[model samples]
Target: MFTPVRRRGTEILDDPNADAALSLRSLRDIALANRFFGGKRAVVREVATLLRRHSGGNEPVSLLDIGTGLGDIPAAAARMAGRRGLVMRTIGLERAPMLAAAAATRCTDALAADAMHLPFADRSIDIITISQVLHHFEDAEASQLLQECTRVARMGVVVGDLRRSWLAVAGLWSSSYLLGFHPVSRHDGMLSVLRGYTEPELRSLIERATGCHAGVTHRLGFRITAVWSPRYRRA
Candidate 1:
């Protein structure tokens, strides 16, 4: 069972040490495997679906992906947008300089920046994505980061992450023992579940932090996702 931490009257989970746990080599390998197996692809597809529905298949979309470790999500978005002759400019942000450097080699447009204090101007980006990244922040920091995500994004924000449940925990354990995953990956996966947020909890956090009405939903079989838009029209 996962213990929840309460912050500002909301039950927030703990933070996971996934970035510290996974080595660069292992991170890269896992990213590659995820791309090959459509793990990241599914995430991008959902984002694309949201974009098409909300933007009415608009051209020339811009995206900012937060905590984009290996740039897989942005890269996939770039590819999908390219099919429509829409110029997709994606900027991936990571905290680790080494991880940012590695992603730059793969993405050529990634930046090293803090999520709590993003370097971008206000309302400059069409979409912001946080995929499997929020579990690393404490409740207060995560709330602040979500506020920043809302501040910078012009259209909306999309968050995709693991759901904290017994099934997820059991799957991680089984994968660790049977699938020959790296020790760090196994340990971190379990820790991530413990640190993950439930649907109502995340919705409450976003609404309270950003002061924006948002909708939360589930996707990809076992992941929780949310989308938030500005409360008022922005000039």
Candidate 2:
């Protein structure tokens, strides 16, 4: 019962061809979920700490947030780094042009490209973050994405995703309705919970992909963050 559910379909916002206005609305709901829930905190906290430890000085570090919905997570990460007197150059990458354009408002740069095949050179970026996105893929694709992250990141990678739970599912069901989330948003949000991974599942996946034993932690809002340096010995 603790394992992630095998979802048969995709989330509403996952569609690259979705309607512009509806997609934006769905993204807004997701951004709010990241805020009110533990998504944003889970990612930014781990990433900021990674930046501080890996950074050599006050020189700017680069961050590329994959599948960045509205770029709020990366923006929040940058602010967290700023508080520590560190600089992070954030880039949001979305498969959809519309999302890339929209996220550019907050991120320093936004890219519309295929995530499985990143356009960056090896270890070119200081940090890479993927929040609430890895569960959308199956085992092979998920590992491929992690491998890509390891290939591009000079310092480390932070992966924040939902921690599968019945309580979270039930809570989101009522809360989404109470907050008047759009039907698509409500449906997708609940479905996302069902697709979330347990701590073991996530840890094993990362280890299998990048050969790094990641540090996994649970967050307040039924979230889990897995952080690891790209330069690490295999478990």
Candidate 3:
């Protein structure tokens, strides 16, 4: 049996020429997986913590989620902040126009844009969160994406991604089948996990990108999270 290598492979949804309806279904399936698995909880947990620590001021907090898929995760995080009396302005950014349209209803704002060159000015948003979007790129592009996140995020950035391991890949593949995920999504997810980062690799990548240490931790269901502030500098 051939072991899956860490090299990146293109997911069907990543292709610009992918069928519209298929892509939408694939996105929906991915969102469903996040709900059942620990992906949603991991991101909301980190974003909620960041919001609490920085949301003391009366001003509304701003949050931008790159590759916001269906926009459900940030919507949930925003509601959580509302419960604490902090108004959260959620921005959903997606490269796909169709996905952006669906996300707009769930967020304070939504736009179709590339994450590599964010439309917002530097350090403009209060918080930035990216989930399961990095693995689509190579190390250089991934590092650059992190720089963009740190550049735009004023308060902090939270990253939620998969942990690369054959065991994890197998678990998700089986779970996806039992959950009746779109066939394209199951294949795409397998590639995503193969492209995922280990704990130390993700930490080192963030440190290299931001020139500051990050808090990287493992969550349930092969998820890993990294949180860091752009203001922090290494002594």
Q: In candidate 1, what are the lDDT values of residues 1-235, reduced to their tens digit?
A: 6534422221121223435435564565457535543457656766676566445455567889887777878888888877866677788888777668767755638888878898989988888998877767777988999989988998878887767777777766775556566765666666666677788888887888888876787655356777877644233
**lDDT of each residue in 1-235, candidate 2, tens digit only:** 4554656568877777788899888888889889899799989899877866764775798999999989999999989888887777999999889889989989999999999999999999999999989988889999999999999999999999998888888889888987778999999888888888888889999998899989999898999999999889484
**Candidate 1 ranges beyond 4 A from true positions:** 1-22, 29-42, 53-59, 177-179, 231-235
Error of 3 at 98 (Å): 1.5
The candidate, 1 or 3, that scores higher on TM-score is 3
What tens-digit string does per-residue lDDT give for candidate 3 at 1-235? Answer: 3445686678878888889889888878878888988898999999878876784578999999999988988898898998988888999999978889988988999999889999989889999999999888888898899999999999999999998889888998899889998888999999899989888889998998779789999999889999999999577
Residue pairs with colliding backbones in model 1 are none
* lDDT for position 101 in model 3: 94
Query: Which candidate number has the best lDDT?
Result: 2
RMSD of 2: 1.5
Whole-structure CA lDDT of model 1: 0.71
